[model samples]
Structures are given as structure tokens and as C-alpha cells.
Target: MKTKLTRRLLCGLIAAPALLWAGVQAHAADIKERTLRFAFVQPKESHMGYGAQKFADLVAQKSGKKMQVKLYPNGTLGGDLQTVSALQGGTIDLTTMPPGLLVGLKKEFGAFDLPFLFNDFAEADAVLDGPVGKQFMERLPNGLVGLAYWDHGFRNVSNNRRPIAKAEDFEGLKLRALQAPLMIDTFKALGANAVPMAFTELYAALESRAVDGQDNPIVAFATNRFDEVQKHLSTTRHVYNPLMVMASRKAWDSLSADERKVLMDAANEARIEQRRVSREMEAKALAEIRKKGVLVTEVSPQERERMREKVKPVTDKYVKEIGEDVVSSFHAEIDKVRTAR
Candidate 1:
């Protein structure tokens, strides 16, 4: 009887883990297995791609490998406009794009395109992760959901011509601008002949001297090797670009509450990682670009102010376009951040 009892006890112990595993799987039965597509315009090794992969890993882990996220980087799917349309149409599951690219969907997003709006990451983080940011997210289109905001660093000018020391330096220079009304207006207001174009075509355009200059974060300016084609880089810091992580409302609606929680949590976590890496990369790229013999010009405080004043009218036009209440709320949020500091 003792020998028989021992055998039964051992068997029970061996079966215990299997029973627990079965229960856990049963509990997660509502999470259907899926293969989702995530697309972004940056290269696979960029901060954007890193964030996407982080989110994908988190989803897979939390969902017990039920959800597989396939990544399409380097604009493999399409440009930002096309990606946004695909997300809205449910052809794509996720994307991370600059807010300026989203103006067509919600003009209020143009608020982010305002020159010199954010002094640094602290101010930006305070506004974007707080109430004002939530307001923008809530107003996103019916078929799209804003997940989180990641840093795209500050926009600076890179040119094949002379360095921009003041607002006047922008005069008559043809600059390739993002395909957004606010961006075009902002550059035009600063006296540059802003040529709106897709990012994918920017390199060849620069090589062909189709545009005299362009503005982007240092990381992009260097990583895209714009330094090779351009001779000067000015630290204008005109716009603080933020990457908006978005999800398709159709894909979001199809998920169970638990699945949604996993995705949301993962996005927030990945945001932290993405911003940290972006800052590091920006610093490294700046050093690399300088080593390449590019004439790096640092715009003085007075010149920065002059440039800001030049574009003040552009801001005024967009405030009305973006709605008074939204702009007011944004200012109120900024005020809170300043006071807290």
C-alpha cells in the first residue's frame, strides 16, 4: 500500500504543472492568435524601428505568443500619408509618424508644428504626456487611435549653401520641407522657398541640387548621410518633432479588453526606451557629422529669437486653424509645467 501511494503521489506532482498550464491557457482563450503588420518610414535600426520591435515583443510575451507583429520599415509599405490611410482602412495595424504628417486627419496636430513651441524635452514631455496631449489623442479620427508620443528630437537646418546665422539667411534658399501646410508656411514665413516633398525622395533631390537645404533632427540629418551631400548644418532648433504611435481602430476594436491593455502598456513602455535612445543617437550623430568636415553653425540666442519672431505670424494662422480652445489648453498645460519646475 505504501509503494502504491508513493507512485500515485509522484504522478500527481508530474501532472500538477500541466494542469496549471492548461488553466492559464484557458484563461487567455479570448486572445485570438493574430499576425499583425507594423510599418514606419525609418530604417530598421532607427529609434522608430526599435520602438516597434519593443512593442511587438511585449505583445508576444503578454499574449503568450498568440499575436505576431511583422514589421515593415524604411517606408516599405508607403510614406507617412499612405501609412495613415492604410491604418484608417485597416490595411496596416500600427505606425509611428510625426504629428505634422497627421494634420490632414486632425488639423489640431499642427499645433506641434509651431516653431520654438518647446524649449526642450522636459517641456515637451510635460505637455505631451499630460492633459493637453490626451486632448489631441481623443480628437483623432474615428478609424485611428493615438497610442503614445515619442521624441523625434529638434529640427535643425542642413544645406549645401551657406550656414544660416539668422532669419535672413533663409532668404531665397530652396529648402525641402515636410509635406504639411504648417511646415511649408513656417519655412516660407522665415523667407525660405519651401519645397514640399516626400522624405524618400529627399536624398536624390539634395544630390541633384533640386533643393538647397532641409531641416531635420541631427540624427536623421547624419543617418541619412545628408552631411555627405551638404556642407553646412545650423542648429536652428526650430521645431520639436514628436512621433505619434498609432493603432488602427478596426484592429483595436477587434481586440479583447485584455489584449488592448497589453498593447497600451507595451506602447508606453517602448516610448521610454525610444526617447532615451533617440537623445543618445542625436548626440552621437552631431559629433559624427562634425568629424565629416561639415560647417556646423550654432545659431545664437538673438538669432533664434529673430527666427521665432519671423514665424510668429505662421503660429497665429495655425492657432485659429487648430481651434482656440485646443491652443488655450496647450498653453495652460505649458504654464503648469513651468510653475511645477
Candidate 2:
């Protein structure tokens, strides 16, 4: 579970721009802008792609054809890492992506990857939608603009090898990671030899035995075609990934205030739609993944708890590597959740 980003994050990200552009009056005249491109990875049927399409539709309707958001899905925009860089460089206008990828842009984000941090989706929503969420959002302006967070759901383990009934089953296996440092460390703690690689390259990597296993939400695994390679499905639910939608600050400034409102509202609408759809789709995806000839390994609760206890040090080291306050705030949020009931 990641510590929430507070309003401080919201304010920081919207902090005063250094210098205003001169041609705002001229740009305002052209209210009928042709099209705006929103990028996402995965195929059109995946949550990322579907939500992006919904967002585009929202913006089109709200703006009365003044602007259109064209979606470039299925890596047509590029891989996770490449697309984020493109957004920062203003080569891309918008994108829906996993927040874990943003950790490279800000180490504080690693706090989100701590093992056993969140118990369920409700608790996660409480932190992210509250001050903690706003605080995390604020940190993005230093590198990229922060938008609403979309759920990627609980991450489970899948492999063609033996059943991971306990932490020991993961030992010596090479697991694919989203090229993030914390994930590499997480798999290492689980006794798996972790391989950090691009998301787009993961399928081929697994098929070729370049990596033996990968962890992801069920929807993502099936959507990305990894089900075709590795045949084992382990519902380890090790992580809860949330998608971050952002716009290029440079591209943002080029639009009129009204134009920006249309885009922002569209993004927010997309965020909500994406979360609902993912919440619904994961079960079907899980069922479908099971039908696709992959063995589903379910880790018992006792063993899952044992794995969490064993990974305590991974959490500790990351707390220091990220920031103590970030970790503290997360624990504090959990405390509130525990006290709530």
C-alpha cells in the first residue's frame, strides 16, 4: 500500500508557473481545436485502453467538438517507460499508466510498494482519495503533471513451474518486474531471482525463459498475452497497483483555460470509469485465465501471512530508501482503517 498524497501534493503540482506565455489571446481564438492524443499501453479491450476511450468521448461531448482525444493503445504510443518519458518531454499529450512506473521519477513513490501495506481496495481508496492521496499527487509536478489515480487491482503471482503454496515455492525462480527498483527488491525478498524489464518485452522474455515468472493483476496478465507463455497462475496478490493519468505540462500550457477544463474533467471521468470496469473485469479475467490452460495456484491464508511476515525487512529497507514520513503516514492511515471497524 502506498502512503496517500495530500492536498499539499495537489497544490504543489498546480504551483505557480514560472512565466506565462505571450500568445494566449491568439490561442484563445481557435476554440475549435481538431484533436488531442491520449496514449495508453495494452490492447483496446484492456481497462487502460477502454477507459482512455471513454475519457476521449467525455472530452469530445463536453467540449462540443472543440477538441477530440484520440487514443493510441496497444503500445502504439510506446512501452510504459517510453510513454512516461514522452509525456514529460511533451511528445505525448496524455496517458493512463501504473503509478509504480512513476517511482523512477520520484523515489517517494516506492512507499506504495511496501508488502502487506493495504488490506483491501476500500482502504486504498480512503488513503488515495484523502489528504494522503493529494500529497502524493503534489510530488508529480517536479517531473510530470499528476492526475487522478485508477486502480490496477491486487497483483498475484503466475508461473508455469511448481505451485507457490508458500514463500519457499518462489525460491530461485526468476520473476519479471516493471523495471522498478522496489519490485526487484520485493521479488528478491520472496527468494525469487528478479528480472527487471520493460512491460512490452515481458511476454517474449517469459516465453523464451528469459524470465520464469511475472506478477500482475489478472486483467493485465490476460490482456497482455502473458497467459500464452507461462502456464501457472498464483494468486499471491502481492501488490496493489494504481494507474496514474497525466498530461504533458508543456502541452497543457498550450491550451486555453476552458480547453484545460474539458481535458481535466474528461480525465477524472475516465478515472472513475476505469476503476469500476477493472473491479468488474478482474473476476472474469481470472476465470478466463484459468480456462486458458494455466494452472491456478492459490496460496492459503496462513502461508500468505507467513510470506508477509518474512518480507518485513523489505518494507523496512524501502521505508529508509523512500522516506520515513511517507512510511509513517501510510502506517498511520492503516491505523485509522483498523480503528474504523
Candidate 3:
């Protein structure tokens, strides 16, 4: 009788934990079935908005309808600052934004956006796909996990004034820049007197002559219709912009292991698809911008060299401020790129 009682007690102890575990999974599943909201500033027509939607769709599919993401585009949720603020405070679950805005939260992120740091998408991809991106992602906490960096392509100067073949032309022009600190400093250093503006406000600012010009990739200019108001496009390729896709830490913690795996897998898949779309559309966007009456200017190699020389000090100062180790890692990644190839 005593042996039978001991055996019965052992069985109940083992079964109790399994029953509790099953109960937790069911609870988590219920929580996961609710909506997830993502925010970005661009319109749904733009690739930035569409790419984010693609990510949402992937998450929904992979999670077997366990999650659904609702997108807030065109500043419906808020501008970049507000969106990031929400993400940090757990008021927003996800955001696809340029890394520039997050620098206040992680100053080392600024290192990724330093003027003229990357020559093109290939080099940018290599660096972002490697250690530089890895470190930047790990540097943030607020439940921020940088799943991948989407290319914003190279930024060029667009103006209603004459073509800019030299740096002197930038003097006194009211240029519109993304509220990026380095971009503000870089344009100021060039004597352009830039006004930082949100994307939603840019067209009106350009149309009313509140700002004389703005900068973005040719593809973005054409697709987003910035080329319509702006009369000139100079291939300055000033900064290599990358979109950071992040999720809220608070929301992420409540998820099960299976749910986490599904979300991450979907993000990885969306990145691969987004890269292909970016490349396929780039040349076509450039052609379309030219067709839209935007006079495109190509600075000669010597002229580009002179511009780089001018911005070199701007780059050096940021490195000093960020840290020696960060600067070293950045240079090592850049050293891997070559123009001749």
C-alpha cells in the first residue's frame, strides 16, 4: 500500500508541470493572435511602405494567422521621431525607419550614416551584412532588434536652380535634408544652409520655394514624385541610406519560442525579396526622373574627389566623437571595398 501511494504521487508531480506548460502555450497563442502595428512615414505607393507590408504579410503567413500586422503609412501613425518614441515606450510594436533618427538612442548608429562613407549599394551591403550592422543591432535595447538593413540607394542633390557642377553652387541654397544630424552637418559644412524636413512636408516646401532643393536616390525621387517639383538632379551620391526594421522588446518577450522563430524567419525572407526589388527598379527610376524634365548632372571624377576631400574632416570628427574602436571597425569594413572592380 505504501509503495503504490509513492508511485501515484510521483506521477502527479510529473503530470502537473506538463499541464501547466500546456496552459501557458494556449495563453500565449491567444495573446499572439491579436494585431501588431507597424509604422513608417512614406506613402503606401512607395517601396518603403510596400516593403514593410511585404514583411507584415510574411509574418502573418509564417505564423499561420497567429499574428496580423496593420501598417500606418504616410505619417498616419506619426513622423520618424514620434514613431521611434512610440517603439521605445512600447506604444508602437514595429517601425521601418532610417537609422539616422535612432542615433539619439544609439549614437554609434550615426557611424553607419557618415557622409560619403559607402560608395554604392554593393559595398554598403557587404558592410551592413557583416560586423558593422551586427554591432549596431546589438547596441540597442528598448526591445529593438535590427532584423536587416534595406537599401535607400544613394542620395543626390535636386534643385529648381541651375545644375551644380561644383561646390560653390551650393552656397546659400535652401536645401531640404532628412532630419539626420550628419546630413545637417554635412550640408552646413558645404554652405548649403539646409532645413531639416519630414518627407510628407517636402513637396510643399519645394513647391512654395520654402526650400530650393532636396536630396534622395534617383529611384526614390522618381517613385515618390520628388522629381516633379525639383528641376535639377545631381548625382552627388552623398550618403548611403539604409532602412532599419525593428520590433518592440516588450512585445517580443511575450512570444513563445516557436513564435519568435516564425517572426525572425519572415524578416529574413522579406529582406532578400526587398533587395531584389531595389536593384530591379533603380535604373528605371533614374531614367524616369530624367524623362520628367529633371536635368541630371554628373560630376567628373576629379570634382567628386574634391568634394570627398572637403567632407573628409566631417567624417574624421564623427569617428573621434563616436569612439576609436567604432572608427577602426568602420574603416576595416570600408577597406574591403574597391572602385576599380
Q: Which residue segments of model 2 deviate by more than 4 Å?
A: 1-30, 141-143
Worst 10 residues of 2 by lDDT: 17-26
Total backbone clashes of candidate 1, pairs 3 or more residues apart or in separate chains: 0
TM-score, cand. 3: 0.87
Q: Each candidate's lDDT (Cα)?
A: 0.88, 0.80, 0.78
**Better structure of 1 and 3 per lDDT:** 1
Candidate 1 ranges with C-alpha deviation above 4 Å: 1-29
Per-residue lDDT of candidate 1, residues 111-184 (tens digit): 88888887788888988999888888888877999889988899999898898999999999999999999999
lDDT tens per residue, model 3, 216-269? 876678777887688888888878788888888877777777777766777778
All candidates: TM-score: 0.90, 0.88, 0.87
Clashing pairs in 1: none
Positional deviation of residue 47's Cα in model 1 after best superposition, in angstroms: 1.4
